[model samples]
Target: MTNARIAALAALGVGALVLAALGAPPLVVAALVAVAGALEVVGQLGPIALRSTLRTPDAVSRAAAAAAALAALVTTGVTAATVCAGAAAVVALGVVWLEGLVGYAWREATRVVERLPGYTAPHSLGARQQVITAGWYLAVVLATLTADGRSGELVLGLAALVVALGTAAAFVLVTRAAIRAKATVTARIAQALRSYDAPVMVYLSGPEGTEYQLGVWLRTLERLSVRLVVVVRETALARVVAGMTSLPVVSAPAMADLEGLQVETFRVALYVNNGAKNGHNVRYRELTHVQLLHGDSDKPSSYNPVTAMFDKIFVAGQAGIDRYAAHGVEIPADKFVVVGRPQVADIAAAAPGAPLRTVLYAPTWTGFNQDNDFGSLDPTGPAIVRALLARGWTVVFRPHPYSLDDARSLAAIEEIHQLLEADAAASGHEHVFGDRASSTMSIVDCFNLSDALVSDVSSVPADYLYSAKPFVITQVDDGPSDAFLDEFPLARASYVARLKEPGSLEAALDALEHDASSSEREAMRSYYLGDFPRDEYADVFGRAVEALVASRCPAPAAPVPGTPGGAR
Candidate 1:
């Protein structure tokens, strides 16, 4: 607690004791406690998380708390005050429970299970929380009846509230049932209507949106010998068939889509993320599910608990093999296939002279929320860019797509662009924020143009490792374990800068461009990516997919290890 709050709490406690000494009713003492609790909660959760309580069961709880306060002031006998005291307890408990629900704070329960590590199916985390809360509420309400002076009326009122909330929950379930039934029927129609057969199904099984990463998998594996079909959940990606790949795009809108389709036809089912829909695809009695992750990065997503479910994981090299084993996910050794990223072949190679000029300042996005977000664009991007510009290196600022989704990141990107716009011509150092400063510029082209990469702990460094070029990765924060650093050897190999230090970027660039960092960078690349035979990674990746199709055996330690939360 802050010193001010601690002192205030002490004073408040003394005042409560003074009121009780003056012969104030017990209900008044209870009311004082409840009000103080509300203040403590406001301090803890803040106002925004508590806002929902103003409309929920918490509203009734607050009213009951008020009645307790009124009774404490007016009631002379014990019965009125006893009932009011019980009401205060009920209200306080209800308000807390309701507020917790509104903010989805109880979802943190999964962290307990997450401690087990490896892929476990998704759990009904929110439902589990509600049950636990209700149990606490019941225990507290019953305890209130054991008070020195209690009434029958308080018991009746508490029972009625329980019955009311239970019915409301049941009604919501019924509404959800209707919606699910309709979806199930639609999915069935999709499966039955299409007479699709493929040896390999590239399952684009994330939620409705966020299938952009699938483009790389599609583009890389398009030249495979096994019959390939793209399975997506949205119809909007029909253009993927026409524009992105040679394979037919199968859109599954619901679960019934899996039921009606011939599951036996596909020899291999490729999975990326552990979306609930993907879980349904895995449940197929026959097909072999391969976890072809979107990218090989040091991020937690790369070695998720969900990975245990795949029959095989098409990993880049030895690094991925060591990663899962080190994280305590014990998958069979044979399942971790060393397939160099086929897409790397498509990325532009380092020019004959690529250590000094035209640096690619590509920083990763601040993930879906703050916790997972590793974006340095806002904190250190401009300082590093200005430093590079000062050094007379032509800078190409390519920000992550999701980075500019928010106002804060968008503003940061704008500052970098404005700096480039004002200074590019004057400094005789031309820069490209092409397509009017949009993400339209391809990553391959970006790699082709720049000599070195400056990125966060994202797939960028892994991808750049293939170019046999120098790159710098940022250490967003301290407290990363020794294991995490080892899993991502690139951090050890390349120019690793702390976000707070712009000079680190300069140091990495200076060393790589003019010193022996190039040799160390190459060794790190070899360690992570294994041996690459020229630029023929596509051929290697194709053979891995073909081998999976040949075996048709599922991988052990599936992500779903029976948890329902494994669902999207």
Candidate 2:
């Protein structure tokens, strides 16, 4: 049978099943099938993005027809089959009324708004439309079946209605033009197969939402090697990742599409988290995954499942290793190495003292949930920064990336700055300002120049443990606000301050500025950032890369059929 015939058969089969499930009588099912089928016909116009303005009338007509079909179903479901004809009329009227309401609402809403055509075109008939149509049809058929007592004629009528309606719906949706063209997938495969001159593989989470630390990591990787290929999502992120890494990058298609790419001698896949969503097979089977995950020293990570798959796991500190172990994430102790974050390492090595010290104030973004009360900086963030500046510290406001990008957040910062400027005593230094060009500065740089670190619950403080400098966390709330720091205990390296209480920030700054001891700094540094071995992570990293290449290149005792031809 032709593809069209198959499509029709599928639709008819589904409709018959619906009839059976609903136990609806014939006429009710027929109306629903028509509505559903009509919408499918309307869908032939193609995507809403490409349609012309003339499709509006057709769209309205289809919406009315579908709505009417639903009304018929409802009436039939509630009433007997003897009244099926009357129920259909009432249902059709209801659809007409809804169509009018929708049309009016659309016009009023879009009156001043310029609507490009095709916006409403695809609604002519789709899955959502069909679902409602089928539901209505089912309701009416059941009512008719119940009223007619499931007689031979009634059963045959219902079955015929189901088939006819289902066939029509299928023909509408699975049109000749709607046939799947495998050419695009084939082209994508071809693209993946092309040989690269020098390919560098970079694995990152979906682009755009990466932490500032990632920027530091990307920059460090590019400086060390030239042929960097970033494996990330397609479209907008490809440009951003390419721009950030300053290297040519390629995104991997689905796992099957990865078959053709030539594996580079230097290619390394990096993992920032232990999540399974990142595709276990693609990273483990096809590439050399370098796990530089994003989580802290809390709880067992998703990394446990695929620990054996990685070439190397770049850990933060002993605490990180201990935490992972405590949580049952098994790492081959020998393979796990403490490569101080390449990004953090770069930040640490930057010229120690800037002309003036800067305070990097960052906070996490409120997630999609309405319960976003947590993780806000003390309302007194600006006031506290002012207090620090009074004692001779330049505050560089770095709100969370989400907050920084949001218009309301930028406006709030501007308002706060104005509040500070209004006070003659507060405007003491040019250094107390938001770094407008923050997109260029890595989070590590923010840490490097900071004389004292001040933040609420953020991974920055955890990272700041490496600096072992005077640190202060605002006790924004008396309660679990400190859970993040308390759980890690690494935060005690810095003085903790309360935000709600008066003079808390001033007092913390005073202690940080005058009373911090070298011993304290050393203890914190050792705990958070372990000492680098041989003074060179590059040599260490290079060696790790070489080891991975050696392991993968030499054929194992037995190789799988689909495995990369073991470095031969």
| Maximum-TM-score candidate | 1
Estimate TM-scores for all models.
Answer: 0.61, 0.56
Show the colliding residue pairs in model 2.
24-141, 24-142, 25-141, 73-136, 200-229, 272-293
RMSD of each: 14.6, 14.6
In angstroms, how far off is 3's CA in candidate 1? Answer: 47
lDDT tens string, model 1, 69-168? 3334333344543445444445544544454354322211121111111223233333433443343333333323323244564564455345435533
lDDT of model 2 at position 168: 41
Query: Count of backbone clashes for each model?
Result: 21, 6
Best by lDDT: 1
Number of backbone clashes in candidate 1: 21
